[model samples]
Target chain A: MAESDPHPQSSPVEPVSPPAPATAPVDAEWHRMSPRFVFVGTLRQLRGLVIPAAIILITGNVGRGGSELILIGIAVVFTVLAALGSLIEWWNFRYALTDRELVVRSGIVQRQERVVPYGRIQAINVSEAPLERVAGIVRVTVETAAGGTADIDIRAIAQDKAPQLREALAAARAQARQADNGIAEDATGAASTVATETPSATTGGELLRRLSTPELLALGATSGRVGPMAAVVGATLQFGAEIMPESWWDRIPWQQAEALQSVGVVASLLFVIAALTWLLAIGSTALAFGGFELRRDGDHLLLQHGLLDRKRRTIPVARIQAIVVGEQLLRQPFRRADIRFESAGGEAEGAAGDSGVLFPFLPRAEVRALLGQAAPEFATDPTVPMSTRLPRRSLRRYVFGATVGWVVFVGIAAAVLGLWLHRWVDVVTWQQVLLLLMATPLFAWLGWARWRDGGWVVENGTLLLRWRSVSRQTLITRASRIQRREMTADPLQRRVSLASVQLSVASGLVGGHYGLAHADRHDTERLLAMLGGPRHEVVIHKVPATVEPS
Target chain B: MATNTFDAGEAGTSRVIEVPERLPDPLHQLDPRARQLWRLGSAISGAMFVGIVALGTFGAARFLPDFEMRWAWLASGITLALAILNAWLSPNLRYRYWRYDIRPDEADLQHGWFTRTRQLVPMARIQHVDTRRGPLDRRFGLASVVLYTAAGPAYIPALANEVAADVRDRIATFANIHDDL
Candidate 1:
């Protein structure tokens, strides 16, 4: 990225600060982002055309049978317009470090200015646009705790300046907090610890774990991310088939496929598709987390990753609402899990204000050690073969819940395919259709396992709820951080005196909800009562008004 | 929850689960006039839906001269019947189920008979509060107190205007969270 490039020409700007800004002072000159920002941004906008342009060249013609020159003409017009827009946007962009806030002003048609208070700043990250693969530019996204959106993004800055600007902002934030708190040092150090990617481990930070090549590649192969990519690729292929000519359909080796049916050609095709998906997963995972490093400096966890983008994230240990230990279906055999912690009201799965996955792939046994040095709050390990499992009566419900739906669905499919479809077009043989019924036992077994795996416990104020579907997920959260608790039951459950409890903890735009279904009503009620649920009428006079409303 | 009378993890050992004597009752209810508001709201929306169905029926007649208005009539009949039923029966049942109480530390809510649900939102978690009133609601002299927490908005609907204001105040006064996180 351009941000990573050394900027020999750019002079270092002095750290400037006055008092806490009330609004904008007319006399103060606002600082402009890098001029290179504009050039890279324009190219970034044009990046979408690369695929189309390459396809057009390879095809050697324009279609819908349109003229080649006309296509190029349209492309040239779009390119010019995009470049002009980028240039104008860059010219209007301005930012300044106030005493307690970072003031940024930018708009195309509307005059917009955002003042992000340093205290509420969740993360100030150095990220690259997914398309800015070759471009040396970077994006400085300022995320606030207000919501899971990037409040301010300074796009396309020189690599070296990222560290400098981050430090200046940090220094101002420290001063601001110091004056605000009337203390020289706060435990949070909120923004005092400047977000830096230049090897922060040397500065009072402990390096926890850095994934090696074998580990990173292994993580890629087993990661749950492959499923979505495969779906996307499948969708794209379907779309492509719709757009392609009839001649394209003639290229397939269907006769060979039919001949190889006895050799389980369908299974082999599925295997091939799975392998391709695995390969794609590895490539994307490596690119995303090539040199993933986990470091802890007092109350914050610094994450440095992305082979190409070179993104860095700092998560305040105190802000974390819940930590998730998840074992994907493929990774279960290896006894590996990914550890990620969600902070309150921050962006999901991306470069800015990311749900911090400190250990993208780790041996399940070592999670305790990692949690101890990292976040001791989540160090309470709910053991395997949990003793607090759901009641045995709940087994029938779980098994019925999982199996009934699938059995019905499969039954309907078999009827449609074997009886109706075969009558008209011999698409599926009765025996072949009947083979699907074999999956019912698998579904039933999964349901039974889910019941066995479901467990909940509250110990030392840390609530642990464990459940397994296709993947096993164990959520560990502080009781105090839980924003709300919910218990629900249906008529059937009412008869059995069973209920489900869902606890919501603040994470991202909407809080994350984790729950266990079919817990005994008594246990659910007990759990709720423990988590501050009122069992008896509460006296209104006890809590003195905490705040005087304006 | 503080009782800790039993070990919860011992559930799988075939020990009998003690059914509690009774669940707590969030007995404090909404304003009696709130039912009229919900009824009016449902009726208006139902009327609009019937109007749309009638329009669709007429519009289709132009394209398909042979098109019978059977589906439209059936749909309109169902909508009106459901609307009438809702306006008559649901308002009372809903009012009976909808209950909320503001405790010192949290707000307790219970509703939905078929799928009973109870929610507890902590006082510290409340980010802001608003008293919302629509024209229809205003006509009925009812308002809703919405509590916006970091998680999401929790709604306590169909309160008297003055009562809504009081509830909003109590929630707002308690929700002034100063945490930077």
Candidate 2:
């Protein structure tokens, strides 16, 4: 394997032999991470100064010779200072693996140390940026089960040593699990013993799915990042217009052009904007997930992808908090969906945002098969009638809710015409009233569609909550993963005996909450009862205080 | 108060566990000193508002030729009215509505005036507990207990000092959250 080199140039300490025994000492000597980390750290510090440097250079008074020289001197000083600081940080940072914990000591001025137990490690990711790839090094990020951001990030390490570190950590975690099980067995004789099998220290894994070039291109084209791309393009265009030459505007005929010609210009501009946005989105997606591949290795799911910065993310199946299958407005008609995992720790590599997208784009028909193969635990029986649809009474609620905004808008227009403008009868024509009236059916249709798509299902200890706003999403998660369940009713909902059931899971920093809105109160209660039904040992009760005569 | 018991059927033994009639606890008021804390907070905000009004009046007198004092009076009157309401009426309403109870396996919180909310945090999901004392709380000999779960942190504000510490300790013990964890 490419990740098992014996002679690493960066490490100051000799590499510890593989498979450290389960009974290793509690306090191990600290070892510095790869010395190449100083380079990575310097790069990170310099990255923040790029825009400032560019601005300084662009706005510098080059005509005044001394001022330009001063600016260049200041830039050089800052670069040197940043490099020195990165070197100091690299000197201060050291990490050690104890018997049960990974201890990291860092900070130059005020010393700080963090200890993460092996049992708490949720996932490990190995990624390389363009610079690190050039240096033949990788960045390792360790995520704990704390459900916040990543616990620690080793910015740079030799590519060959990354896998060895991962293997050692996995082995420690397995031993910790065995120790925990042994203690539990001693406490309760009836407790079943868990197998103490370590993950195989090899690269081979069962290939579950791989995206081909054509499919990858299709994914890029259908990515749901058009909105962000459009914003970026709009900002860029605004900036371009500000910096554009005045002679360019003078060349165009503004007043003499025909109305049709102006309209044609506007239409072409819109087309250009849309095309640019589409091309940007596709190019970005292609760069991020060009060679996406998912493989199952022992108990971990390995994801490898990226074009410029090739990356690998290993996620244990047990750490996944929820699975989100999303169908965007543009891709639904073409029968495509995006699959994402909400894990306990930070996002996996190449996951553009907080979403740990396993596959950016996949055929809708094959989603079930993929889920069955990749994560069978989340797959439920398709034939079972588990969906509890909202009633027709709820449709009235939805329509009223949807149309309230339109009502406000029309009321404002009427007030302006009748009171301020005093053109009530003359300006408010029947055609305008008809156009306003048309919004009612449009809102009603939207309400009906939302009600049609919204439903909740519980099967095999997993709850599937499906809802739609602009796009439809079905969140599938184990009922046990839910930390809290809430059923709330506003005054209006209470009048209709409708309530919203919200389930909070331990995924993201604030946690992920999925709500099934406007469900019947009885049904919500039934669902809550079902969640608490299977637990045999513990039953909690709230005791009301007895009122005393005052 | 009613008791509902459900019987668990095993091969030879049948055991019944008593369940409460309601899923939430009966309303329990917060510390009486919370009213004083609320009043003090309102007073501080009211003082800041007065200062701002004074500054605005000075700015207008120096800068503008035709600055009406009636608008300033109206704004101050509205601000005072809101401050008075928050200082006097809101505290009572909040105290009446705010209630919390910690069970062996879960914690139930019911609060809010117009839009009532009831939240439950299972003990098993609790991550940590903290007791916070701000300046006013310290003056009033009161504290607030914050319970952190994986989802987020929820606070029980304006409890007596001893009660806050006791609640924090009890929750920490119940959740099995050690200092190191």
Candidate 3:
């Protein structure tokens, strides 16, 4: 990908402003991104193709049949096109730091040009992959208020340049803010000229206080089915292979067998590998993001994470749509907690922002403290913890309904499987049928556990609602962010004076929900008041001065 | 010193706001692109029909059942021709009608070389503004000013570089003046 010059819309010769002075501090406006940025980005993009290419090659070989020559030629063409595309994409990608903006120009045919004016850029994130670390290159991604979709990555820059660029962007943003605050006449020229050099705020060593290897191992071990599931499947497949005749293996060709291996040996091996791999991945990820801390960098919260990706997310404090604090039964044993915030950006797994796992595991106390510190306004009354509400008698109905469904499913499966085996081998007996019948109680018990955990609590402006099954999710969001609210009561619930209230938020980030079912009218009213539901009447509750973390 | 710059500019203020070409509302502004897409789609469909005819009339007559691969060249030529036509016609037709006007407090963008659109974005609503010049823009010394708000970013394309700079500064000035409101 050849770098399309900064702005194809205007000429380079057009006078915008004079270049920065040589004496400009190292911590100045924007550090010119490395020339090798395209090379590194191209490499990163190509890395993703490796897995897909392997899949296509395997599939093509299997489907080739008698036309092996044609298949081989097609594969060669595919490889060549992919390789050429990687090169074209690499050549087309270019990033630069002008006095006014951080510019990224990329694309093969229809070029996309992203301009992050220093003032509007909220975050500068530098992430180092294991391979990049070896290459002494890090990816510095720039995030702006525009959204995460256009976040620009200046790839393969020197490790040293990451901090410098981050600082430069920060200072540039600060200058923009200064301009906005009426400190400067020309928001443009004056921002470029205001000279100040401050060393980038170094991430303190306190972040290293994250979980130990044992703690991480314990977390991964607790309630993780992938490992045990793999072990069981592996044992089953091994048993099957042992029982199957050699003729069965001979009848299936090698290509056919290899394709099936993913569901067979590979699937089983994944679990075995996942058990240890998850432990290590979690530990390393925690270490990298441990002591995860956030601070106000101008109007944005500057976040630094990673032992490897070493990413920084500059999220505008105001763009935060909602906040969620999650804890699982497994994490309960260790008293570890996961805290995530939903921000207006692109989607990511495990968190709201495009960056995954904002703060994966922290102590319950730490979660509150961090939320309070990071977003003080939204985290009003940090001392006041949320009140808990558990589902009442009506929960029994929900549980019973769930059991009936589960039993019906299992009953159908057992009847069909048992009938099929009866003619050929010994079918499942009455004892097996009785055991299957017992599954209703099992499902009911699980549902009851979930109902027992579900509740809603209003903490000043923030609403904390907890929902749980095997996996637990607790969401805490601001009252104003709720875009819409719905109150529903079933015939059973109405008889028992129970209602379920749901709140919708703008955008899909913190789903438009937090259903509080079968609570007291006073409790429901309290929720309605917090949501500013139809009545607009709220009974403010006063709490004791003494504070505690639950 | 900062106050001095504002004080100096106040004395030379021009009240007669120049209403240049206006850009339509966000949905309307995309009209040109939408029309182009419709045209391109129809063209491709028409080409497909023509391809069938050529294959039957000429391809079967010449290449016959053996050298039928020759149709690939015809398809590639048609596709490339369409692509070149799209690049040339789309931007040229769109900007020809997109009208913009910058006032002291807000920007009124009216556009639609074909389907008319009008949008009024208050200066205060602009969270930030970005000015960019592409290769084509550079040749004409034209630039694009993108005004970003909480909803999304809107573009004012094909302004002269100096004019773009001036408009950006003016918008920034308005944003500051009305920020409290």
Candidate 4:
């Protein structure tokens, strides 16, 4: 009967009430976030000014005498101002859940209010950072279908209240959708439906997958982008050299050192660098994805992971535009691949590892099964021979495009060195020229590889394009997600009746454009037609007979 | 290959559906005033170039001992020749090649002289449409219709002022977009 109360809002309004009964009519009333939000807001404001304050203090010390106190006073004044701003922001912010939309009113100076319809919400993420965890609170972010501008972030809420808010919002969305579909429901019925749909810890979800510690370690070991690590190591060595005492350098006895000893020292240095990079990579991966678990709740996939700061991300399957399966060169031999998603609306830009990854490392064999279980619409026969490889003629084009310019530039440099510097033997030896000539064949092989790996396949309403630059990438995207279509051909491609087809799809900050080069002209036309272009008719011409012959 | 003859109602009257080799209608070219706008812009740029060259020659002659003014003059003369050629030729070429077609579902644009690029943007994907007029464009009574899609914005440049506004409104209508708060 409590669940069936039609006019919950009719109850007497109470301010600052503790956790209410499950059937309470708090939905229509404005509610301030958890009181702990003040602390979160203050910290956030302080974090923004930390670097500036540090710079001020450092410069104050270096510039003159007794200016330190003045700089300290300025820093204190800045802190007080920021704290007051945060207090005002916290005071002005209030959120209310109406029947149709979530209305958030906030802003001290601008007087801003955002009314987000429940039906438009794409996903809700509840994350607990280290500080929030200690404070016994969580941060909730609501994303809507209006792309970048429509996201709403609630900085701090009690941990227990988060799940309730999520459930309430979800039930509201479902009711709205049902109402839109012509389901006439009384207020009591809607209330009862919401009560029934509210999910508890043990209900409404099925565990799909979880990553073990060993798997996480493996993922870290095989993680891509070693170049950054190398750069970091180089920078660290340079810094170390600057900080080290002169005696440390003299201790190396470089004047009397033998070539073998120097070589050993260099080898050990490389070893140390590699070991440190590996350790750092592993440490970071474990921290980010230590206890990863993916669960399914109706149309949403809930992913929770982290070592220190737990994050719960709800991804609506419908908003996903594409799925990319990437296999790094080092991981390919082990038959492991990383899976990422291209979702339509969320943060415009995100950390490389944070936003898109569905899973970091999965055995290649299991990718299809995983996709089937999670996103069945994208599932297809992975072994199907639907891909059409680039033509042999394209190999020459690739080679010429990739290497000819560099080869010619090197040739000119060598010629200049030989003629102008009169140092052909020292600067541009015959061996060097031979090496430059050999690059042609080497680049030809690379071009052949690229051609072999490059292909496009259409199946199950999705276009799967596979291409190779440094590492091979396979992009599987639905045709409906494509925003634009372009067929381009240079003079050379036109002569061969070849064209490149580019499909623009909503992704990342600016959107992503993927192209399949050297596709047949007829195939490109067919692709256009498939993408809802005008239907084309083929005409046959008949030769006329001469009347004089009769 | 074998040819089969089918009977026709009238003794040799045969009809076949033809897939046209080119677009059904010729592409709509930019407004002719676009050429005048380009020429004005080029002339301003040429004047700036001449000023820079004159200043550099004067500075070198006054400051440097071994500086030869003839080489500077020759270089400046070559630049002015190129500028004049561009002013005379490039506007015509650009106007000839820039064409656009706005259909109910999509907009197709083709432009460029030597390396032509064609783009097709579906109406449903257009996020916003705007009409922009620069100072020179305002004097010429011309504007550009810029369509913003998720991919990026595309411009149909140098249309008559009213036409640009009309095109923008048409695209907005076709896209079925209404501003929402």
Q: Highest lDDT: give the candidate number.
A: 1
lDDT for A305 in candidate 3 is 57
Q: Between candidates 2 and 3, name the one with more favorable lDDT.
A: 2
**Model 4 alpha-carbon drift over 4 Å, by segment:** A1-206, A260-272, A304-312, A346-355, A381-386, A404-444, A518-522, A533-550, B1-26, B45-67, B177-181
Best by DockQ: 2
Candidate 3 lDDT over residue span A357-452, tens digit each: 546666766766676656554553222334756546767766876788888887886787688767854687777778878878878986787777
Query: TM-score for the second chain in candidate 4?
Result: 0.81
Better of 1 and 3 by TM-score: 1
How does each model score on TM-score? Answer: 0.65, 0.62, 0.40, 0.61
Of candidate 2 chain A, the 10-residue stretch with the lowest lDDT total is A185-194
Best by TM-score: 1
Clashing pairs in 2: none
Model 1 residue B54 distance off true place after TM-score fit, in angstroms: 3.0
Q: Among all windows of ten consecutive residues in candidate 2 chain B, which has the lowest summed lDDT? A: B3-12
Return whichever of 2 and 4 wins on DockQ: 2
Candidate 3, residue A427: lDDT: 81
Give the TM-score (0 to 1) of chain B in model 2. Answer: 0.79
Score each candidate by Cα lDDT: 0.69, 0.66, 0.54, 0.65
Candidate 2: tens digits of C-alpha lDDT, residues A1-550: 1123221234444333221122112448666667777777777888999998888678866657588778778878977887788776776566678765665655543333445555445456678999888777887777644446556677777889888877777666555545554433222211112233434423558988888888877887777778899999999998897898999878868676556457687898899999999999889888889888888877777788889987777666656777888887778898888888876642233121134887777888787788787788776532233478887779887777777767778878876886677642346655676689777877777777778788888876788888877677888888667777777878778788888888887765777788877888777766765664332223322222223211
Please write out the lDDT profile of model 1 over residues A1-550, one tens digit for every residue.
Answer: 2222121122234222222222243344467777776677778789888898888778865555668778789889988887887866776567776444566656544334454545445456777765443556577886544345565789866767778877766565555555555545442343433333432433347888888899899999887779887997777767896899888668777787577667577678678778877788889999999998888887678888889988777776767888989888788889888898877632223322336687888889888888888888888664544546788889999899888988798778777876778765557656664687778888899899899889887776888889987788898888887888899998889899899989987776777788999998888877887777333344322211212221
Q: Is the docking of candidate 4 incorrect, acceptable, medium or high quality?
A: incorrect
